[model samples]
Target: MSPIELNKRQEEILQIVKNNGPITGEQIADRLSLTRATLRPDLAILTMAGFLDARPRVGYFYAGKKSAQALGDTMNNMKVKDFQSMPVVVRESVSVYDAICQMFLEDVGTLFVVDEQSLLVGVLSRKDLLRTSIGRQELNQIPVHIIMTRMPNITTCKKSESLIEVSRRLIEQQIDAVPVVAEEPAGLRVTGRITKTTITRAFLSLSESHEL
Candidate 1:
Protein backbone atom coordinates (compact mmCIF):
# COMPACT_ATOMS: atom_id res chain seq x y z
CA MET A 1 0.00 0.00 0.00
CA SER A 2 1.10 3.53 -0.74
CA PRO A 3 1.69 5.98 2.09
CA ILE A 4 -1.13 8.41 2.78
CA GLU A 5 -0.22 11.56 0.91
CA LEU A 6 -1.23 14.70 2.74
CA ASN A 7 -1.58 18.25 1.50
CA LYS A 8 0.31 21.13 3.16
CA ARG A 9 -2.46 21.73 5.65
CA GLN A 10 -2.67 18.08 6.69
CA GLU A 11 1.09 18.00 7.16
CA GLU A 12 0.87 21.10 9.32
CA ILE A 13 -1.96 19.59 11.36
CA LEU A 14 0.06 16.44 11.95
CA GLN A 15 3.05 18.45 13.08
CA ILE A 16 0.86 20.33 15.54
CA VAL A 17 -0.71 17.16 16.96
CA LYS A 18 2.71 15.58 17.25
CA ASN A 19 4.11 18.58 19.13
CA ASN A 20 1.13 18.96 21.44
CA GLY A 21 -0.12 15.43 21.99
CA PRO A 22 -3.80 15.07 22.87
CA ILE A 23 -4.64 18.57 21.56
CA THR A 24 -8.23 19.19 20.51
CA GLY A 25 -9.07 19.64 16.81
CA GLU A 26 -10.45 23.09 17.59
CA GLN A 27 -7.10 24.11 18.99
CA ILE A 28 -5.24 22.79 15.95
CA ALA A 29 -7.57 24.72 13.64
CA ASP A 30 -7.11 27.84 15.75
CA ARG A 31 -3.34 27.56 15.24
CA LEU A 32 -3.86 27.46 11.48
CA SER A 33 -6.40 30.33 11.67
CA LEU A 34 -9.15 28.06 10.30
CA THR A 35 -12.53 27.04 11.68
CA ARG A 36 -13.13 23.62 13.19
CA ALA A 37 -15.72 22.87 10.49
CA THR A 38 -13.11 23.32 7.76
CA LEU A 39 -10.81 20.90 9.56
CA ARG A 40 -13.38 18.14 10.14
CA PRO A 41 -12.66 16.17 6.98
CA ASP A 42 -8.89 16.36 7.39
CA LEU A 43 -9.21 15.13 10.95
CA ALA A 44 -11.44 12.27 9.84
CA ILE A 45 -9.03 11.21 7.12
CA LEU A 46 -6.07 11.35 9.44
CA THR A 47 -7.82 9.29 12.11
CA MET A 48 -9.39 6.77 9.75
CA ALA A 49 -6.21 6.23 7.77
CA GLY A 50 -4.49 5.50 11.11
CA PHE A 51 -2.31 8.57 11.31
CA LEU A 52 -4.13 9.77 14.40
CA ASP A 53 -6.60 8.69 17.07
CA ALA A 54 -9.56 10.64 18.46
CA ARG A 55 -11.05 10.50 21.92
CA PRO A 56 -14.50 11.84 22.69
CA ARG A 57 -14.51 14.88 25.03
CA VAL A 58 -10.71 14.85 24.71
CA GLY A 59 -8.81 15.36 21.45
CA TYR A 60 -6.65 13.93 18.62
CA PHE A 61 -3.35 12.12 19.17
CA TYR A 62 -0.90 10.58 16.77
CA ALA A 63 -1.01 6.76 16.72
CA GLY A 64 2.52 6.54 15.25
CA LYS A 65 1.53 3.80 12.80
CA LYS A 66 3.56 3.53 9.60
CA SER A 67 1.62 5.50 6.99
CA ALA A 68 2.28 3.00 4.19
CA GLN A 69 0.68 0.11 6.05
CA ALA A 70 -1.80 1.80 8.37
CA LEU A 71 -4.57 2.31 5.82
CA GLY A 72 -4.71 -1.37 4.85
CA ASP A 73 -4.44 -2.55 8.43
CA THR A 74 -7.18 -0.24 9.66
CA MET A 75 -9.57 -1.17 6.86
CA ASN A 76 -8.87 -4.90 7.13
CA ASN A 77 -9.65 -4.85 10.85
CA MET A 78 -13.25 -3.85 10.09
CA LYS A 79 -15.15 -7.12 9.60
CA VAL A 80 -18.25 -7.21 7.38
CA LYS A 81 -20.48 -8.71 10.05
CA ASP A 82 -19.56 -5.86 12.39
CA PHE A 83 -21.16 -3.45 9.92
CA GLN A 84 -23.50 -5.56 7.71
CA SER A 85 -27.28 -5.09 7.68
CA MET A 86 -29.80 -7.89 8.03
CA PRO A 87 -30.54 -9.49 4.65
CA VAL A 88 -33.94 -9.31 2.94
CA VAL A 89 -34.40 -12.62 1.14
CA VAL A 90 -37.15 -14.09 -1.01
CA ARG A 91 -37.68 -17.64 -2.22
CA GLU A 92 -37.30 -18.66 -5.88
CA SER A 93 -40.99 -19.62 -5.99
CA VAL A 94 -42.09 -16.06 -5.08
CA SER A 95 -44.06 -14.28 -7.79
CA VAL A 96 -42.53 -11.31 -9.57
CA TYR A 97 -45.53 -9.17 -8.56
CA ASP A 98 -45.18 -10.15 -4.92
CA ALA A 99 -41.41 -9.58 -5.03
CA ILE A 100 -41.99 -6.04 -6.23
CA CYS A 101 -44.31 -5.43 -3.31
CA GLN A 102 -41.77 -6.84 -0.88
CA MET A 103 -39.08 -4.60 -2.35
CA PHE A 104 -41.23 -1.51 -1.96
CA LEU A 105 -42.22 -2.51 1.55
CA GLU A 106 -38.66 -3.28 2.56
CA ASP A 107 -37.35 -0.24 0.63
CA VAL A 108 -34.18 -1.97 -0.62
CA GLY A 109 -32.56 -1.88 -4.05
CA THR A 110 -31.81 -5.63 -4.26
CA LEU A 111 -33.08 -8.91 -2.85
CA PHE A 112 -31.34 -12.27 -2.29
CA VAL A 113 -33.01 -15.33 -3.79
CA VAL A 114 -33.00 -18.57 -1.83
CA ASP A 115 -34.33 -22.09 -2.42
CA GLU A 116 -36.44 -24.50 -0.35
CA GLN A 117 -33.30 -25.57 1.52
CA SER A 118 -32.67 -21.90 2.39
CA LEU A 119 -29.52 -21.94 0.24
CA LEU A 120 -28.81 -18.95 -1.96
CA VAL A 121 -29.90 -19.50 -5.55
CA GLY A 122 -30.09 -16.14 -7.28
CA VAL A 123 -30.66 -12.39 -6.92
CA LEU A 124 -33.44 -9.96 -7.83
CA SER A 125 -33.05 -6.30 -8.74
CA ARG A 126 -35.47 -3.57 -9.80
CA LYS A 127 -34.12 -3.73 -13.33
CA ASP A 128 -34.66 -7.48 -13.53
CA LEU A 129 -38.28 -7.14 -12.45
CA LEU A 130 -38.93 -4.10 -14.67
CA ARG A 131 -37.53 -5.86 -17.71
CA THR A 132 -39.55 -8.99 -16.96
CA SER A 133 -42.71 -7.02 -16.20
CA ILE A 134 -42.60 -4.88 -19.37
CA GLY A 135 -45.14 -6.87 -21.43
CA ARG A 136 -46.00 -9.66 -19.08
CA GLN A 137 -49.41 -9.42 -17.52
CA GLU A 138 -48.90 -12.69 -15.67
CA LEU A 139 -46.50 -11.28 -13.08
CA ASN A 140 -48.43 -13.18 -10.44
CA GLN A 141 -47.93 -16.44 -12.33
CA ILE A 142 -44.28 -15.82 -13.17
CA PRO A 143 -41.80 -16.84 -10.48
CA VAL A 144 -38.61 -14.95 -9.59
CA HIS A 145 -36.47 -17.99 -10.53
CA ILE A 146 -37.43 -17.32 -14.15
CA ILE A 147 -35.74 -13.87 -14.05
CA MET A 148 -33.24 -13.84 -11.21
CA THR A 149 -29.47 -13.72 -11.86
CA ARG A 150 -28.40 -17.16 -10.68
CA MET A 151 -25.35 -18.40 -8.74
CA PRO A 152 -21.88 -18.28 -10.34
CA ASN A 153 -23.29 -15.30 -12.26
CA ILE A 154 -24.09 -13.60 -8.94
CA THR A 155 -21.36 -11.85 -6.92
CA THR A 156 -21.28 -12.71 -3.24
CA CYS A 157 -19.21 -11.85 -0.14
CA LYS A 158 -18.50 -13.61 3.10
CA LYS A 159 -19.14 -12.46 6.68
CA SER A 160 -15.37 -12.47 7.25
CA GLU A 161 -14.57 -10.26 4.25
CA SER A 162 -13.45 -6.69 4.80
CA LEU A 163 -15.76 -3.82 3.85
CA ILE A 164 -13.05 -2.16 1.72
CA GLU A 165 -12.84 -5.17 -0.63
CA VAL A 166 -16.61 -5.67 -0.76
CA SER A 167 -17.32 -2.02 -1.50
CA ARG A 168 -14.71 -2.10 -4.25
CA ARG A 169 -16.47 -5.03 -5.93
CA LEU A 170 -19.83 -3.26 -5.64
CA ILE A 171 -18.47 -0.28 -7.61
CA GLU A 172 -16.57 -2.38 -10.14
CA GLN A 173 -19.67 -4.44 -11.02
CA GLN A 174 -21.91 -1.35 -10.78
CA ILE A 175 -24.26 -3.26 -8.50
CA ASP A 176 -26.00 -1.63 -5.58
CA ALA A 177 -25.29 -4.51 -3.17
CA VAL A 178 -24.27 -8.11 -2.59
CA PRO A 179 -25.43 -10.87 -0.31
CA VAL A 180 -23.08 -11.97 2.53
CA VAL A 181 -23.08 -15.72 2.18
CA ALA A 182 -21.62 -18.74 3.94
CA GLU A 183 -20.53 -21.95 2.22
CA GLU A 184 -22.70 -24.80 3.47
CA PRO A 185 -22.71 -28.49 2.66
CA ALA A 186 -25.52 -28.02 0.12
CA GLY A 187 -24.49 -24.63 -1.24
CA LEU A 188 -24.00 -21.01 -0.29
CA ARG A 189 -26.28 -19.84 2.56
CA VAL A 190 -27.31 -16.21 2.76
CA THR A 191 -26.37 -14.71 6.10
CA GLY A 192 -26.60 -10.95 5.65
CA ARG A 193 -26.45 -8.17 3.08
CA ILE A 194 -24.01 -5.34 2.30
CA THR A 195 -24.94 -2.34 0.20
CA LYS A 196 -23.49 1.00 -0.84
CA THR A 197 -25.72 2.66 1.72
CA THR A 198 -24.51 0.29 4.42
CA ILE A 199 -20.88 1.17 3.71
CA THR A 200 -21.74 4.88 3.58
CA ARG A 201 -23.39 4.59 6.99
CA ALA A 202 -20.36 2.77 8.39
CA PHE A 203 -17.96 5.49 7.23
CA LEU A 204 -20.32 8.23 8.34
CA SER A 205 -20.50 6.66 11.78
CA LEU A 206 -16.71 6.47 11.90
CA SER A 207 -16.27 10.09 10.85
CA GLU A 208 -19.03 11.34 13.14
CA SER A 209 -17.49 9.65 16.14
CA HIS A 210 -14.17 11.40 15.55
CA GLU A 211 -15.63 14.79 14.71
CA LEU A 212 -14.61 17.59 17.02
Candidate 2:
Protein backbone atom coordinates (compact mmCIF):
# COMPACT_ATOMS: atom_id res chain seq x y z
CA MET A 1 0.00 0.00 0.00
CA SER A 2 1.03 3.58 -0.59
CA PRO A 3 2.43 5.58 2.30
CA ILE A 4 -0.55 7.90 2.10
CA GLU A 5 -2.76 5.05 3.16
CA LEU A 6 -1.12 5.02 6.58
CA ASN A 7 -3.12 6.86 9.22
CA LYS A 8 -1.49 9.19 11.71
CA ARG A 9 -1.48 6.58 14.51
CA GLN A 10 -0.03 3.95 12.22
CA GLU A 11 2.72 6.29 11.09
CA GLU A 12 3.49 7.17 14.68
CA ILE A 13 3.81 3.51 15.54
CA LEU A 14 6.08 3.05 12.56
CA GLN A 15 8.29 5.88 13.68
CA ILE A 16 8.55 4.38 17.15
CA VAL A 17 9.48 0.97 15.76
CA LYS A 18 11.94 2.51 13.36
CA ASN A 19 13.65 4.45 16.09
CA ASN A 20 13.38 2.01 18.97
CA GLY A 21 11.99 -1.26 17.89
CA PRO A 22 12.59 -4.51 19.72
CA ILE A 23 10.79 -2.24 22.12
CA THR A 24 8.18 -3.88 24.32
CA GLY A 25 4.45 -3.42 23.76
CA GLU A 26 4.06 -1.81 27.18
CA GLN A 27 6.71 0.74 26.31
CA ILE A 28 4.96 1.67 23.11
CA ALA A 29 1.58 2.03 24.77
CA ASP A 30 3.03 4.12 27.57
CA ARG A 31 4.81 6.47 25.20
CA LEU A 32 1.76 6.93 23.00
CA SER A 33 -0.61 7.34 26.00
CA LEU A 34 -2.66 4.45 24.77
CA THR A 35 -3.39 1.21 26.56
CA ARG A 36 -2.08 -1.96 24.99
CA ALA A 37 -5.56 -2.89 23.78
CA THR A 38 -5.99 0.46 21.99
CA LEU A 39 -2.59 0.25 20.32
CA ARG A 40 -2.84 -3.36 19.26
CA PRO A 41 -4.79 -2.73 16.06
CA ASP A 42 -2.41 -0.04 14.83
CA LEU A 43 0.56 -2.30 15.54
CA ALA A 44 -1.06 -5.16 13.71
CA ILE A 45 -1.80 -3.04 10.64
CA LEU A 46 1.79 -1.82 10.36
CA THR A 47 3.21 -5.33 10.70
CA MET A 48 0.88 -6.62 8.02
CA ALA A 49 2.07 -3.89 5.66
CA GLY A 50 5.59 -5.31 5.65
CA PHE A 51 6.88 -2.26 7.47
CA LEU A 52 7.75 -4.17 10.62
CA ASP A 53 8.42 -7.55 12.16
CA ALA A 54 7.33 -8.71 15.61
CA ARG A 55 10.09 -10.68 17.21
CA PRO A 56 9.56 -12.90 20.26
CA ARG A 57 11.53 -10.94 22.83
CA VAL A 58 12.19 -7.90 20.73
CA GLY A 59 8.66 -6.53 20.57
CA TYR A 60 8.88 -5.13 17.06
CA PHE A 61 11.37 -3.77 14.54
CA TYR A 62 11.32 -1.92 11.28
CA ALA A 63 11.63 -4.38 8.42
CA GLY A 64 14.69 -2.69 6.99
CA LYS A 65 18.02 -2.56 8.79
CA LYS A 66 17.39 0.65 10.72
CA SER A 67 14.75 3.35 11.05
CA ALA A 68 14.98 4.48 7.46
CA GLN A 69 13.28 1.63 5.61
CA ALA A 70 13.98 2.26 1.92
CA LEU A 71 17.38 3.65 2.72
CA GLY A 72 18.20 0.74 5.00
CA ASP A 73 17.34 -1.85 2.38
CA THR A 74 19.65 -0.14 -0.09
CA MET A 75 22.47 -0.39 2.43
CA ASN A 76 21.91 -3.94 3.64
CA ASN A 77 21.05 -5.41 0.25
CA MET A 78 24.48 -4.69 -1.26
CA LYS A 79 24.83 -7.82 -3.41
CA VAL A 80 25.49 -5.69 -6.54
CA LYS A 81 22.63 -7.72 -7.97
CA ASP A 82 20.34 -5.34 -6.08
CA PHE A 83 22.10 -2.01 -6.57
CA GLN A 84 20.47 0.06 -9.29
CA SER A 85 23.42 2.23 -10.25
CA MET A 86 27.10 1.63 -10.86
CA PRO A 87 29.70 3.79 -9.15
CA VAL A 88 31.85 6.29 -11.05
CA VAL A 89 35.56 5.44 -11.22
CA VAL A 90 38.80 6.89 -12.57
CA ARG A 91 41.99 5.17 -13.61
CA GLU A 92 45.08 5.46 -11.40
CA SER A 93 47.17 6.74 -14.32
CA VAL A 94 44.96 9.84 -14.84
CA SER A 95 46.34 13.32 -14.17
CA VAL A 96 45.30 15.29 -11.08
CA TYR A 97 44.10 18.04 -13.38
CA ASP A 98 41.90 15.57 -15.22
CA ALA A 99 40.60 14.16 -11.95
CA ILE A 100 39.78 17.67 -10.71
CA CYS A 101 37.88 18.37 -13.90
CA GLN A 102 35.88 15.18 -13.51
CA MET A 103 35.06 15.85 -9.86
CA PHE A 104 33.74 19.31 -10.70
CA LEU A 105 31.89 18.19 -13.79
CA GLU A 106 30.13 15.41 -11.90
CA ASP A 107 29.63 17.59 -8.80
CA VAL A 108 30.94 14.77 -6.64
CA GLY A 109 33.48 15.16 -3.84
CA THR A 110 35.17 11.73 -4.14
CA LEU A 111 36.56 9.62 -6.94
CA PHE A 112 37.52 5.98 -7.01
CA VAL A 113 40.92 5.15 -8.47
CA VAL A 114 41.11 1.73 -10.03
CA ASP A 115 43.46 -0.46 -11.99
CA GLU A 116 42.94 -1.89 -15.51
CA GLN A 117 41.69 -5.11 -13.92
CA SER A 118 38.92 -3.06 -12.20
CA LEU A 119 40.21 -3.75 -8.68
CA LEU A 120 40.06 -0.60 -6.56
CA VAL A 121 43.55 0.65 -5.74
CA GLY A 122 42.89 3.99 -4.02
CA VAL A 123 40.52 6.88 -3.44
CA LEU A 124 41.07 10.54 -4.36
CA SER A 125 39.13 13.50 -3.09
CA ARG A 126 38.81 17.13 -4.09
CA LYS A 127 41.15 17.95 -1.22
CA ASP A 128 43.79 15.58 -2.57
CA LEU A 129 43.46 17.00 -6.05
CA LEU A 130 43.65 20.62 -4.88
CA ARG A 131 46.59 19.96 -2.57
CA THR A 132 48.60 18.54 -5.46
CA SER A 133 47.53 21.20 -7.97
CA ILE A 134 48.51 24.15 -5.70
CA GLY A 135 52.12 23.04 -6.18
CA ARG A 136 51.64 23.75 -9.90
CA GLN A 137 52.15 20.12 -10.79
CA GLU A 138 51.90 19.22 -14.48
CA LEU A 139 48.19 18.94 -15.26
CA ASN A 140 48.53 16.18 -17.84
CA GLN A 141 51.46 14.20 -16.49
CA ILE A 142 51.01 13.69 -12.73
CA PRO A 143 49.33 10.33 -12.23
CA VAL A 144 46.75 10.00 -9.45
CA HIS A 145 48.34 6.68 -8.41
CA ILE A 146 51.01 8.72 -6.59
CA ILE A 147 48.73 10.47 -4.08
CA MET A 148 45.69 8.18 -3.94
CA THR A 149 44.86 6.32 -0.73
CA ARG A 150 46.03 2.76 -1.20
CA MET A 151 44.36 -0.44 -0.02
CA PRO A 152 44.22 -2.58 2.41
CA ASN A 153 44.14 0.66 4.38
CA ILE A 154 41.38 2.20 2.31
CA THR A 155 37.92 1.44 3.78
CA THR A 156 35.74 -0.67 1.52
CA CYS A 157 32.50 -2.67 1.52
CA LYS A 158 31.75 -5.89 -0.23
CA LYS A 159 28.52 -6.03 -2.21
CA SER A 160 27.04 -7.99 0.69
CA GLU A 161 28.11 -5.44 3.28
CA SER A 162 25.72 -3.08 5.06
CA LEU A 163 25.55 0.60 4.13
CA ILE A 164 24.98 1.59 7.75
CA GLU A 165 28.47 0.25 8.47
CA VAL A 166 29.74 2.25 5.52
CA SER A 167 28.10 5.43 6.85
CA ARG A 168 29.66 4.91 10.24
CA ARG A 169 33.05 4.66 8.57
CA LEU A 170 32.38 7.83 6.62
CA ILE A 171 31.63 9.73 9.82
CA GLU A 172 34.54 8.22 11.73
CA GLN A 173 37.08 8.66 8.94
CA GLN A 174 35.61 12.01 7.81
CA ILE A 175 35.37 10.77 4.24
CA ASP A 176 32.55 11.37 1.78
CA ALA A 177 32.20 7.99 0.10
CA VAL A 178 33.09 4.30 0.28
CA PRO A 179 33.81 2.01 -2.62
CA VAL A 180 31.46 -0.97 -3.01
CA VAL A 181 33.46 -4.00 -4.10
CA ALA A 182 32.38 -7.47 -5.13
CA GLU A 183 34.55 -10.60 -5.00
CA GLU A 184 34.49 -12.76 -8.11
CA PRO A 185 36.39 -15.79 -9.31
CA ALA A 186 38.67 -13.40 -11.21
CA GLY A 187 39.29 -11.17 -8.14
CA LEU A 188 37.62 -8.16 -6.50
CA ARG A 189 35.68 -5.81 -8.76
CA VAL A 190 34.47 -2.31 -8.06
CA THR A 191 30.70 -2.53 -8.21
CA GLY A 192 28.97 0.50 -6.69
CA ARG A 193 29.26 3.40 -4.25
CA ILE A 194 27.61 4.42 -0.97
CA THR A 195 27.75 8.10 -0.10
CA LYS A 196 27.15 10.27 2.95
CA THR A 197 24.52 12.34 1.19
CA THR A 198 22.29 9.32 0.67
CA ILE A 199 22.46 8.33 4.34
CA THR A 200 22.11 11.93 5.53
CA ARG A 201 19.09 12.51 3.38
CA ALA A 202 17.44 9.37 4.61
CA PHE A 203 17.91 10.39 8.23
CA LEU A 204 17.12 14.04 7.57
CA SER A 205 13.76 13.05 6.19
CA LEU A 206 12.88 11.77 9.65
CA SER A 207 12.93 15.27 11.12
CA GLU A 208 9.80 16.01 9.16
CA SER A 209 8.00 13.80 11.62
CA HIS A 210 6.95 15.86 14.63
CA GLU A 211 5.83 13.03 16.90
CA LEU A 212 9.34 12.49 18.26
Residue 77, candidate 2: C-alpha displacement in angstroms: 8.5
Clashing pairs in 2: 78-159
Residue by residue across 1-212, what tens digits does model 2's lDDT show? 11324557777888888888789878998989998855654564455445778888768888852233353443354332223135778998888888999888888888988888888889997788888888866878888899898887788776555546666788898888787777777656888776776566434333322123
* lDDT for 120 (candidate 2): 81
Candidate 1 local lDDT, 1-212, one digit each (tens) = 44456666778888999999799988998999998856765675577667898999899998875544443555676667666777899999999999999999999989999998999999998888889889747999999999899988999999888889898999999898999999988999898889998789767655433333
**What is the lDDT, from 0 to 100, of the residue 40 in candidate 2?**
53
User: What TM-score would every model get versus the actual structure?
Assistant: 0.66, 0.59
lDDT of 2: 0.69
Worst 10 residues of 1 by lDDT: 203-212
Q: Candidate 1: give the clashing pairs.
A: none
**Candidate with best TM-score:** 1
Backbone clash count for every predicted candidate, in the order shown: 0, 1
